[model samples]
Structure formats: C-alpha cells, structure tokens
Target: MIHRRSGSVGAGAVDGGAGWDGVEPQDYDDPSLGGVRKHELIGEAEGARQYRMRYFEVPPGGRTARERHPHDHGVMIVSGRARVTLGSETHEVGEGDVVYVAGDELHCFEALGDEPLGFVCVVGPRSAS
Candidate 1:
C-alpha cells in the first residue's frame, strides 16, 4: 500500500539533479522486485485530488519490475534513454518522448544509456478503500 504525507510545498525552481527541494527520493524497489528510485512531485499533500506526479530514475543496467496496476499512466522521458516494455511490445524512448500505459497493461522500464533513465510519470488517483 502507498502512504500519503501531508505538508508538501509543491514544485521547486531548479530541475538539476533531476530533483526538487522539499521532495525526497526513495527506493522504488519492492522486496519481490528491484531497481529505480522515485521522487513524488505532487500528491494529496499538494492538494491534488485526482492525480499524482512522480519522477523516476533508473540507473544504467537497471530496470523496474515487470508489473501491472489497475491505473493508467502518462509517462514522459526527461533524460537519457530507455527501453520501455508495454504489454508484448518494447520500444526505445529518449528525452521528450511520451508513453501511455493503459490500466492493467503489463509494463517495465530499463535504462539503456550510460546515464540513468529519468522520467516523469502521472498516475490517476487511487480509490480510498
């Protein structure tokens, strides 16, 4: 389950380090899976009622776990290159490229360049259960 924190001040000016002030980067790996660090840009604490924005960095030779969720995702490459697997197809993506992963579609991302693969992902709100 995901946890929500209160008191976020929203975005910062500098995009260097692929991070912003007030936001902390955390491991995106699950005990059952591994690879990737993530920073939450906007969420419930930031007054977002419908969506959340996050940034992910996958180091070279690293990859996110192959998994599927019931939510859709809007992903945009921010830096470096990556190979994104969506469903049965895999494609190369670079900075400025955008990808859409529909709900329940299996997907994963692997860093392909010497540098880390950085990307922004926007996800729809989760139901309160």
Candidate 2:
C-alpha cells in the first residue's frame, strides 16, 4: 500500500510546516535469498506526480540490480558499509556518507560488511518507462 502526508506553503509564509510526517513500514524482499528488506516511503506532496523515499537494508554480501532512474537521487548511508557503484566510480560508503547521483546514471549497491547495510534513498520524478 502507498501512504503519504501533504503540506502547504501559503503566500508569504516563511515556514511551510508539516511536510512528510512518515510512512508505514513496508517490506521489500529480494526474490533470490529472501533475507533482505526494504521499507519504502512514497512521497505525496499535493500536486507532485512522482516522488519517493526508501529505507533499504541490504544483507551481508547482498547486491541490488543495476538500474537507472529518470530523475536525480540522494542516498545517505545510515549504518554498516556499502559498495556503491554510480556510473564508473565504485566507492565504499559508511555512516554519514551521502551520494548524489544524477538522472539516468547506471548504479548499483552491495553490502560489503558483515552486518546489514542501511541507507535512505530519495528519488524524484518517477519514470513511466
């Protein structure tokens, strides 16, 4: 199920309060090993057609499929270690590391540590293709 919170910014209003409370927990299991979980936060801001945020937990040695998005992405590592490949650069990301990947860039991630690697993903302008 998709869930979201709405916010409004009136004219001359400096602070647009109450934007995105939180989303209910939803599991995204890998079809292969069935050990990983991904909790998604689908963005719903009034008129925006496409916006999403996801919390991913990649199990040890687990990897994601090579993919591309129609819009930009902001990824922040929360815990453990992750090997992120954005385009041609592959780097190790840990806690507090943030990566920005532009639109249509081929990217993938793999859990490099013994524990589960967690990260927050923000994607804009969902693709129709």
Candidate 3:
C-alpha cells in the first residue's frame, strides 16, 4: 500500500473573503444554482492520482442542486449551518458534522442562518479511475 499525505497552501475563507491557495473557485455551469463555489484542494494540481478533495461554500439563503449520481462521496461541514436532504430524509447540519452520500441517493444542501455554509467534500477523481 502506498501512504500519501496531501499538502496544499493558502488560506480559505470560512465565512467570506477569498478561496484556498493555488486553487480557484469553480464556476458552475448554471448560475441559477445559487452562490455556490467549489475549491479544489487536493487533486491533479497537487499530483494526487486518486481521490479529489474540495471545499464548497454557499452564501446565506443559497442552495445546491438536488441531484444524484452513481458514485458515493463524503462531506464534512467546516462552517455554518444547512438543511440537508439525503435520499428521503432531511435534517439540519452544522459545523464539524460529517455526512456520507451513497450512490444514486439524491442529496441537496440549503444554507441556513446568517452565514455561508462551507464544507469539505471528497470523491474519487473520474480521470484517475
């Protein structure tokens, strides 16, 4: 087995300001999806040949697209709160909370309270596999 440690520089705004170092926020295809921005922390840019790690942030009152795919992924809330819908269950999630999304399970996140919701997401890089 190969043991690997990810190294990424730069500061990420938990509340608001700028994105992570060396990584630019991704522009969504549909702007109507709300103020959602994703920052790739560890992926091809860092020479990782497996999974990709990203940080997503949505402004207050914003939400993500409700969709599902044939891939399982994980998320860890870094800041703020949100009402998350996974499959048929909906619940409020906040900072430090961890969530697992199964393959083909529909999920969405809606920012709640006064601050933007930020979270770390990890998924297998499609190009690598």
- The candidate maximizing TM-score is 3
Go through the candidates in order and give each one's C-alpha lDDT.
0.76, 0.66, 0.75
**Model 1, which residues run further than 4 Å from truth?**
1-17, 31-35
Q: How do the residues 2-94 of candidate 2 rate in per-residue lDDT, one tens digit apiece? A: 344454212111122212345444435447644455555655543456677776666678777677767898999876688899999999888
Flag regions of model 2 displaced more than 4 Å.
1-30, 44-50
Candidates ranked by lDDT: 1, 3, 2
**How do all the candidates rank in terms of TM-score, highest first?**
3, 1, 2
Worst 10 residues of 1 by lDDT: 6-15
How high a TM-score does candidate 1 get?
A: 0.81
- Candidate 2 yields a Cα-based lDDT of 0.66
Per-candidate TM-score against the hidden true structure: 0.81, 0.69, 0.82
Candidate 1 lDDT (Cα, 0 to 1): 0.76
Model 1, C-alpha of 124: deviation from truth (Å): 0.3
Which scores higher on lDDT, 1 or 2? 1
Candidate 3 lDDT, 1-129, residue by residue in tens: 222323221123434454654666785445897567777778876787778888787878888888886677899988888899999999999888999998788999898987878888898766321
